[model samples]
Target: MTLNTKKDPRVAVIKTGTTYPDIKSRFGDFEAWFIRALSGNLDITVVDVAAGETPDAPGNWDGIVVTGSPAMVSDRESWSEATADWLAQAVAECVPLLGVCYGHQLLAHAFGGEVGYHPDGRETGTKQVERLAASDLDPLFANLPRTFPAQLTHRQSVLRLPPEAVLLARSAFEPHQAFRIGQCAWGVQFHPEFTEAIMGAYLDVQSPELTREGLDIDRLKAELAPAPEASGLLQQFSDLVLQMKKD
Candidate 1:
């Protein structure tokens, strides 16, 4: 059933970037994963900031999943400012939040911290994350493994978290992988919603970036070829949203 604006959970998947050549900028793997997360039941609308906002559906939305952007988190631009406002508003309202990639960075920057280029090589492929006390305590990773496979793609990462944030997961490559704040807000450095195919396209789009950062795309592609177990992670994230709505 279509979730009426007056009832049912409403999730706003904010598109932070328009893909090059108009390759359907829905964050590569988000649309399908989101539809699955909502069990093809809830009302979902992808709000492209370039075109306009999500059309003021906050009254209708029960949750928000902010998508990552291709641009740098430190950049000062109109889109960045507007997106940051959305993040602040979401947290102030205590709306259930799940931020991926740039969304995660946006959260860190919005609350109180910095996100910028990491000298560490770009995390382009699949890797297993070591669980922490934060993970054990969080329901976000309920069904996921202690060391789960996740697709990593980005140039910038969370250097420091908002003081209230609790880290959820990490890896040898990236430490601030996943974190949460005050129970309802959560952010992940990796995309638990991406597929190898979708990521391959992202790599292709960011090949120049990889090269600029002195990394090898061939290696990144080879490592990411093996799909990560994000379906379970996404399911867990979805479950968290469902439970948050119930509360």
Candidate 2:
């Protein structure tokens, strides 16, 4: 669907990669998860970059949501690079944007941040996210608690943020769990769009990796719970976009 001139804040889900193959066979891709997560009263669109779908114009949509991907930002694939370039322009133009996981790293890299293999290795499963003092100033996270849990699964992390980017939240394992570049642009390293089942499924698929990493798989799975505060960000973002459009 064309994003060119929608009355509603048409948010586009830019899919950079598919869900884990096993997860995809059982559930679906990242787009479906985001759609469900947001479930906001607004027009939503899906642009599958993996399938060669790209938005016609950023001005067309009121907001954008970049989904997580399996592809590492360090790889610098042509499509990923192109999407990053487009995201930079989107931010410059004041479009409300939220990037999660791979999208988070891409947003950082697009704006001159360093993204690479995490020294501590993959951080999978539900984890605690501590909001930094600066987070109080961000509308997207002001209402969240100083400390909360969010679903996470990633090997790469944004070791450094772009110049002047606001550090919003962090976890013990991930120093840059969330950040904001421009007023309306944000990048969260955690999966705010995931459910407990999804988290458990991810742990199941990554059990070997977790086992090798010395993490207790059963304990992690049993502890998985819905991250209401983290999950609430999707709707909060939509509200922000709609409110921006109103202003």
What TM-scores do the predictions have? 0.83, 0.95
Candidate 1 backbone overlaps, count: 0
Candidate 2 lDDT (Cα, 0 to 1): 0.89
Model 2 lDDT tens row, 91-139: 9899999999999999999999999999989888889999999988799
The models' CA-based lDDT, in order, is: 0.71, 0.89
RMSD vs true structure, all candidates: 3.4, 2.0
Candidate 1 lDDT? 0.71
Cα miss at 15, model 2 (Å)?
A: 0.2
lDDT of 2 at 158: 99
